[model samples]
Structures are given as C-alpha cells and as structure tokens.
Target: MSEPQTASAVEEERHASWPELFFDLVVVAGAGLLAHLIEDGDGWSSLFLFAVAFGAFWMIWTCFTAYGNVRGDDARLPTFLVGMAVLSVMVAAVPGIHEGHAQAFAIAYVVGRVAAARPWHGATVVVDLPVIQAFTGVLPWIVSFWVDGDAKYLWWAAGLTIDLLQLLRAREDKLLEGAQERLDHVAERRREQLAAHEERARRDGAEAPAMSARARRRQRRIDRLEKAGRVGRQIPTSIVALRTDNVHLAERFGLFTLILLGEGLIQMLNAASGAEWDRMLVVAWAGAFALIVALWNLAVRHGSAGVALLAHGAIPVRVQWVAHLVTSLALVAVAAVLGVVLAHPARTLEEHEVLVLAGALALYLLVSATVHAVLARRGGGVEDGRRAAWLAGAGVIAPAVVIVARESLSAAAVVCVLAAAALLVSVVDRRARLRLTGARDGRAVPASTP
Candidate 1:
C-alpha cells in the first residue's frame, strides 16, 4: 500500500504561474544565443567556452528559479521581469563572449544573482535566507574579469563548481535540521508515554510496568557502553529523511526541459528551411526529430518518476539537481549539433560535430543511468537496475557508433544510426516499464516483454 499524502503534498499540486512562463520565454532567447556560439566553431576550445558560458547562464536561471520555488505565489512579477531584462543583457553579450562582452556577461550574472538571492521591499529574510544563498558563488566570476586568456574559463568553472557544491551543502544542512527535529519529537513522545504508564500503574496501586525485553537489553547495552566511554547514549532514532514539497520545482525543471527541446526543434526547422530541400536533408531532419522524440521520452519518464520519489523523500535532492543540470546541458549541446546536421545534411560530418554529438549523447545517457541506479537503490525494484544497465550500455555504444560511422557514413546516415540506437533504448525502456507494472499488480508479464 502507498503511504498517505501530507496536506503540503496536496497543496503543492499547483502548476507553474503565468509569470513563470514569461520568465521562461526570456530563457529561450538566451538558449538561442548560446546555441549560435558553437554553430561554426571547431575543436574543443569552442565546446569548452560554450560549456562555461552556458554554465553561468544556467546558474542565473537556478538563482531565480530557486527563489520562485521557495516563495511560490509570493514571488513578485516585477522582480522576475527585471531578472529577465538582466538576462537579456547577458544574452546580448553572448555573441561577443570571447571578445569584449565577457565582462558584461559576468556583471549581469552577478547582478542577477544578487537581486534574486532574497526577497525585496524589506521582507523578512529569516524565513527564506537559507533557501536562496546562491550569490556566494559569484566571487570567482568577479575575479575572472581581470584575468586574460583561457585562464578566465578556469575561474568560471570554479564559480560554477562552488555554486553546485553550495547547493549540495545546503541540501545536507536542511536534512540535518529535519532529522534533529524528528529526533526531538520522538523523544518528547517517548517521555509522554512513560509518564502515562507511570500514572496508570500508580492508579492501580502497583509498581510501574517493566520495559520490554528488547528495550531493556538495548538500554543496558547503551549504559554499559557509556560507562566505558565507548559510545554516547542517545534517544531512539531511525533513518529520518527530510521531505519537502518538490512538485512545483520538478514541474519547473520539466518545463525548462520542454523549452530546451522546443528550441532544438526550432533550430532544426530553421536550418532545414534555409538549406535546399533534398532527400538526404529530409532524411537527416527525420532522424534528428526522432532523436529528439526519444530523448523526450527518456526525460519525461525519468522526470515524472523523480518528482514522485522526491515527494516521498526516497532520493536526495542533490541527485535530482545534478540530473536536471546534466539533462539540460546535454540537450543544449545537442541543439548545437542539430543546427550543424540540418545545415549540411549531405556533407560529411565535421570532427567537432561528431565529437560534440557523441559526447552529449554519452553524457545524457550516463546521467540517466545514474538516476535509475539511484532509484533502484531506493527500492524501485530490479527493473530499475535493468534499465540503468541498458542506459549505461547505450551511453557507451552510442558514442562509438558516432565516432566510427563519421568516417564513411553521410551525415544523414550517421544521424539515423543515433536515432536508431535511441529508439531501441526507448523500446527496451517501455518493455521494462510494462513488466515492472505487471509485477507490481500481481499479474502475468505482458506478451510484449521479450
């Protein structure tokens, strides 16, 4: 049987608001600018620059989105729009990222993070301060302005790492607080129960009831250990996990994924329209669309399950955070590849294009595999393990297919190969899901589960 839902869980069913949607539209513009960064560049330098720049941009989104997730309806519209406007300045700076615009980008990012870190108009910061402490990550970015050459990217990477680590640390801190609260409540309940038992025994004109054998034994052990100074005695405690209402946050991330996919599709379509219509181009377009659909299937399935697990406190929030980060970054990189693929469907794939596509596919699947592994470890069943293994296998193989086929295969054929691999993975994932559901229902395995 399922656990009962809390009132907070029921209340968290609310969807994203219109102001949030408006905020996302501005993000879409930023994504487009980031995509163009690597459209014509070669080698890992372009990829590295794109990753760092996009990391900063993603952090900006994280700051505002984190604020919105906590504040909910109280999150101001003007504040979001002002952040959006700052993001626009950041987006405008993207085209000249390596030129004179890097400092502008860093400035906008810092300004945006500061603005979104807490409430405006003299609101009490005590309630929301811990939830939005992302501004501290900007110190490295501030130092990057004076640094020249590739060393600046090192600072950018450090800043993003700090932000990511801070998020994880904050999550740990909240968990500790929740666990302490739970421990205190348990101790209080135990005290009340003991008092009630003593009163009942007194009313009966007899001695207080004896403790259970197991409790007595455990207490004796604790006493012995304390006398020896080997262990500190503590109240009854079990594993306590911090559970919060993550439905809104999950939905927010899901929407952002959808927007990334939409932007990718738009890039593909725009590229197709610009190129001369040919059979190979049509084939490439179809393959690219299929790849996107497969990714959507994977992302949606994992995202929905993740949101459920989050609601139940079955997994760490940091894992989900990292999953979304990897998913978004991979999709952005794929968008850049899609633009290149559609722009020259008949031409041989470039070295950088092959590498970028392969890397993105590999990174995405590996993260998916990690997510599934985490789910399985949290009692999501053996089927989850099977899915993780399959995803990991595909992550390894997909890149090999890209790397090997790039030499002899046309761009369209290479794309088809990737789409085929993704489609096969999707098919396996669907079968595994069906079989798992059947098992849970105490029914026969479905005929389709080969």
Candidate 2:
C-alpha cells in the first residue's frame, strides 16, 4: 500500500505548481508548431523541416528531463522561461524550416541546451566538470558549420548524443547516491531500535532505582534518534523522481503523437477540399490515420503503462527512463515519416514506409513486454505475455485487412474491428482485476459481529 499524503507533504513536494504546468503547455505548443511546419513542406524540404523540428523537440525534452532529474525540484519559473525561448525559436524557424532559418534554429537549440544546463550546474558542487564538458563538446559542433560542408549534421549529432549520454550518466549517479542514503538511514534506524530494546530490557530487570532511571533516559534518547532516522529514511529517493520524470516524458510523447495525428487530419482535409476524395485516396488516408492512432497507443498508452508497472526494482530507474525515452523517440520518428507520406499526393503506401511503421510498432511492443516479464519474474510472478502477443498480432492483421479488403471494408468497418479488439482487452483487464481482488479478499480476516 502507498503512504498517505499530508498537507505539509503536499506543500513540500509541490509537484503540480503553476509554473511547471505552464512550462509543459509551452512544450506542447512548440511541438505542435514544429510538426505543423514539417507537414506543410514537400520532398527534400519536408525532410529538412522534419530534421530541424525533431532537433528542436529533442533538445528541449532532453534539457527538461535532465534538469528535472538533477534539480529534484520543479524550479518552475526558470524552466518556463527556457521553454518560452525554445518556443520563440520554433516560431521563427517555421517560415523557412529548410533553408533560411536553419542556422538560427541550430543556434537557438544549442543555446537553449546550454542555458538549461546552467541551473543544474549551479546547484551541484562538481559543476566545472559538466560545464566544461558540455561547452567543450558543443563548441566543435557550433564551429563545424564554418569548417565542414558535408558533415555539419554529424557534428550536431555527435554533440547531442554526448550530452544525452552524459545526462543519463548523471541521473544514474543521482539514483545511486539516493539508494545509498536510504540504506544508511535504514541501518541507522535499525541500530537505534536495537539500542532502545536493550535499554528497555535493562530498565525492566534493574534492581536499583537510579540505574532504572538512567536506563529509561537512555531509552528515550534512542527512541527520538530512531524516529529521526525513520523520518530520514522516508525521504523519497531519486528513483521515485525518475519514475515521475518518465511519466512526464510519456505525456510529452502522447502530446506529440496527437500533433502528428492532427497534421495528418489537416492534410486529408486539404486533399478532400481539392476534389481528390476518390475511394483509393480516402481509404489510404483512413489507413494512415488508424496506423497513427495505433502507433500512439503503442508508444504512449501500452508502452508507458508497462514501463510504470515494471519500474520497481528490476532495472535502475535512470536506465528505465532512458530506454523509454529512446523508444518514444523512435515512435515519433516513425510517426513523422507517416505524416510525410500522408501529406504527399501519392495514394499507394510505399513498401519502405509500411516496413518502418511495422518494425517500430513491433519493437515497441516487444521491449515493453520484455520489461514487464522481467519485473514479474523478479517479483516471483508472471505476466501473461498473451496480451502483448495479441497486440502485435493485431498490428500485423490490421494492415493486412486494410490492404486486402480496402474496397469491400469501409474505414468505419475497420475502426469497429479495432474498437472490438480494444474492448476485448478491457474485458481481460477487468477479469484480471477481479481475480486479484478475490486473492486479496481470501487473505483478509472476517470482521467480528457488531
């Protein structure tokens, strides 16, 4: 069972403060705008726009996650300011995503990352290492635009990858420090409890009154010390912080997926208005949209739910978040590609696009299922892998149904099948819950008659 929240605890934690919420909103809007800019372009320009947009989104999220993990407090106002700056750059880059604003976008992104790191740097004692490391790593990339013509992107990718890896490492270190602190507190409490028990025993058996009084005093001291140690142990660890951070990351991914869906919808609306609403075109658009929704469910709902369930002790919290973040990005990349394909004039789905989407979906489901299985095994239980198998099987069957029965099965019919499958999963979840409740009741003692 979870601990109850008190008013003081609520005040101290301040997880839902205004500034933090505002910062999240800014990220959502910025991501949507970036997706919109990419969806409005074509061919190589479209790809470039996507790269620039993704770069911006990735930089912002990385900084947010890194700082949130390191600081352990929202520090909302400053975070909001940084978010606004990112949004400003995204707005400026919207006009010429491919050519005119590339340099501006890159500079803004690099500066934003640097700025976000500053607060965390100030808070830590070993600040110079990360600061020097960040600047030294980013400087070459910032300079590469002048020196390298063909491999400029390589410089950016390399620098960004280093920063990301460093962020993960820092988070891992923080979690280790936290676990050590908790262990120390627990040990201290155990010592005090033993001392108290011994002193109480001595007091009870003591023949001399003076000796008994002394023993009582010592017992009181031990009691106070033990209480203090227990309180210290109650302080939440960095692993809990990482779990909350990953939830935020998952929410961000969900928002981006919605934005991609919106982009697809806008493209379809434009196509429909242009009198291109033939049967094949309509079927293609519907399939693309359904694919986007499935991808979103795979990444945000199922994937995140699995992570939240598994992130207990089987893996380090920081590693779990990093893995989830990578998976989320891969899903977003796949969605971006789908958005591009949907926006184009082509009616038939390309083999490469289908393969990419299918592969990403499969990988997402497989990773999540594996994590769940590991967590269950660690807890001396087992997860029915059948649910994961069902989802993956649906992913394969849904596309095939759309392709083979495009003319016979309307989009609404396909949607109904998807809904029915979702309902079936819901039924399974309900049955599992009932069984769990029954097990809990079996362990409960009957109440005495009133």
Candidate 3:
C-alpha cells in the first residue's frame, strides 16, 4: 500500500510567501537608489559606487535566497524575517554610505548577517567564504567615513575581488573533482542517512531496513543530475549542484528578475514624472517603455529566455547563476539609461552620456545573445533557434544605434534607435515561432510552460 505523502509534499512544494515578497520589494528600492546614484555622482565615480553597493546587496540577497531555497522547515520563517528587517535598515542607509551613516550601516549589516547564519539541517556554514566575503564587504563601509576619495572605493573593490576569487576557485575545484567523485559523495551521504534510519528501527525492536524507496529515489535523481554533462551544450562544467525540485531554484531566480525589471520601469516613471507632454517626448517615452517591455518578453514572458536550466541535465548549475546575473545587471543598466534618455528627448546628450547609453544597450544585446545561444545549444526547441537568430540580428544593429546618435542629433535619437532595434527583434521572434512550429521530436523544449 502506498503511504499518503501529505505534509512533506506540502512543505516541499511551498512557493515563496508574502513576507518574502515584501522583502524583495524592499531590496528593489535599494537597487533604485543605486541606479539613482549614477545620476548624482560624477560618471565613473557613481558607476563605481553602484558596483560596490550593488555587489553588497547582491551577495546578501543571494545568500538569503539560497537559504530560502533549501531551508528545512517553515519554523525558521520568523527568524528569517528578522534578518530581512535588518537588511531593510541597511538599504535605507545606503544613500548616506558616502557621507555620515557609516556606523548605522555597519551595525545593521552585522546583525542582519548573524540572523541569516541560523543553521540549516546537515549543511555546514562554518567555512563558507561567501559569508566571509559579505562580512568583509561591510568593512569598507564601516571605515568609509574616514577614508577620503576614490581610495575608499578601491578598498571595497579589493576585498570583493578576493572573496569572489575564492568562491570561483572553490567551485572550480568541485567541478574538476569529476562525476565519479560526486557520485561517491552522494553514496556516502546516503550511507549515513540509512545507517541512522537503521538505528531508529532497531531502537523500536524491529529488523533494520535498507535505504527507503524515497531515499533511493532521491539518490537516483542526484546521480542523473550529477552525471549530467555539458556535452550537448557549450556549458563546460557545473559550479553548483542542482537536484530534486529545480522549480524551487528557478522560481527564486524568476522572482529576482521580476524585481530588476520592476526597478527599470520604476526609474523610467520617476524620470518622466512632471515633464511636458509634447509629441517627441511622447514618442520617445513610448519607445523606451516598449524597449523595457520587449526585453521582458524576450527573456521572461516568452520561452526564449528560459535557461531550460533544470530540464537540461546537460548544462551546469553555474551557467544558470551567470545567466541570471547577466540578466539582472543588464536590465538595471538599460533602465537607468532609458530614464536619462527620456529626461532629455530633444537635447543632444553630453558626449559621455551618449557613449554610456550606447555601451549599455550593446551589453544588453551581447548578454541576450549569450543566453539564447546556450538554450539553442541545449536543444531548446523552436523558440530557442528563432530567438537566437533574432538576438544575432539585434546585436548587428546595436552599433548603428550609437552611430545615429551623432553630436548633431538629440540624445532622443538613441531612444529611436533602440526602439527600432526592439521592433526588429520582435519581428525576428515572430518569424522564429512561425518558422519552426512542431518541428518534430528529439529537441529539448524551451521551458515554454511554467
């Protein structure tokens, strides 16, 4: 007789809750502040500040998110909220980071981190370098009030680099440890689990049993995921181990991306708040808004954006991380640029500003193309092929966008160029779908359904 899998199934399949959603919204506010900094501070300096601040926010968010993904029970929910509250306070102080709120920011960051460190079952956080990195990242902010000028940012940058290098290198070591070694680790874990179960059975005056069917099923899944190679796609190796329910991880990622897109749209609205409603501004506004919306469809709404991460056992976990990171940062930058462009529709952009916008759009295209390429290589059905080609065409046109925004033309011209590019990509996208419908089997589905 099959045992009814009720409570465990309910807990495991639980989606993110209202509290977590609120926490993410708070962090989105922080992202907006970071982008706004670029408008205030001198160009490169502001950009540097955004990088350092964004890096810190991203690290904290990523840690908490991972914890959320694999956390054992709902009992820790309140404790997690305490951590998020402290994080909210820290985010509020970010605007004053270069000024007087150093002490407040430092203390809040430490408290939030301590709360985030609450133990997870079986998983040890004792030597986690990423946590150490997050703490180290706060050090510069602590003494930021004393250190004057760009040298301060240098310290933050140096500390961040050290922490990142360690994480990357450690992940690389695990990847190179090879499939046999990974399988061995899985077996060892299984043994420990079964041995404990046997002890319990004996204590109850019964015969000790072998690994249960559920445990066996989990191990088999891990084996399949671990043995999943990067041969079909260009993803060489996995830096993270993703097994069991991948929707858990993918859902978290999708939430974060939605936040980034929201940040862009929010900035755009803030930029156009009370400005005059002339014909040119209206056209430029619509175009910039469409650009943002089109981007969402390209990756989030449509199947093209699907990393097919969990489905394609052939790809590595790190690819998903990298892809998500690229998507977040690119969308953030696009939002910031669009806001600036919308602000001065008829006026020629400062030479530096024009250059920045051009570079940002190009970066967006490059990252988009990369995401699509991975999906296509993974055999992500018709949408993948169609979207990949569309991305290629948009990339080709991106440069021409900058050229059109010559010194003689208004900065608004850049908006026009990007809009045109967006439309062109849409056309390609439609063509891709129509051109490759039901192209038969042996193809990997592009995660079309939720």
Top candidate, metric lDDT? 1
Candidate 3 overall Cα lDDT vs. reference? 0.58
lDDT string for model 2 (138-245, tens) is 765587557434355556666666755665566434534544465456555666667667757586657676677667776676567557644334333222212234
Could you estimate the TM-score for every candidate?
A: 0.77, 0.57, 0.69
Decide which is better by lDDT, 1 or 3: 1
The reply for model 2, stretches above 4 Å from the true place, is 1-16, 25-56, 65-79, 94-97, 121-140, 147-150, 167-316, 330-346, 373-380, 384-450
Lowest summed lDDT window (length 10), candidate 1: 120-129
Worst 10 residues of 3 by lDDT: 1-10
lDDT, each prediction: 0.71, 0.50, 0.58
RMSD of 3: 12.6
**Which is the winner by TM-score between candidate 2 and candidate 3?**
3
lDDT of 2: 0.50
Query: Sort by TM-score, best first: what order?
Result: 1, 3, 2
lDDT of 1 by residue, 1-450 (tens): 112121132354777888888898987888888987778578778888888888777777866776676667777998888789888989999998778888888889878877876453211121212334445678888898899877888898888888777666665445445545655565566556555544554454443445355455555655564475333434433332213347776788778887888888988988899998989899999999998888777776444422211222345555566567767888888877887789899988887888888788888888777767887898988777887788888888978977977888778877788888777888886777678789899998966676
Error of 1 at 180 (Å): 14
Ranking by lDDT: 1, 3, 2
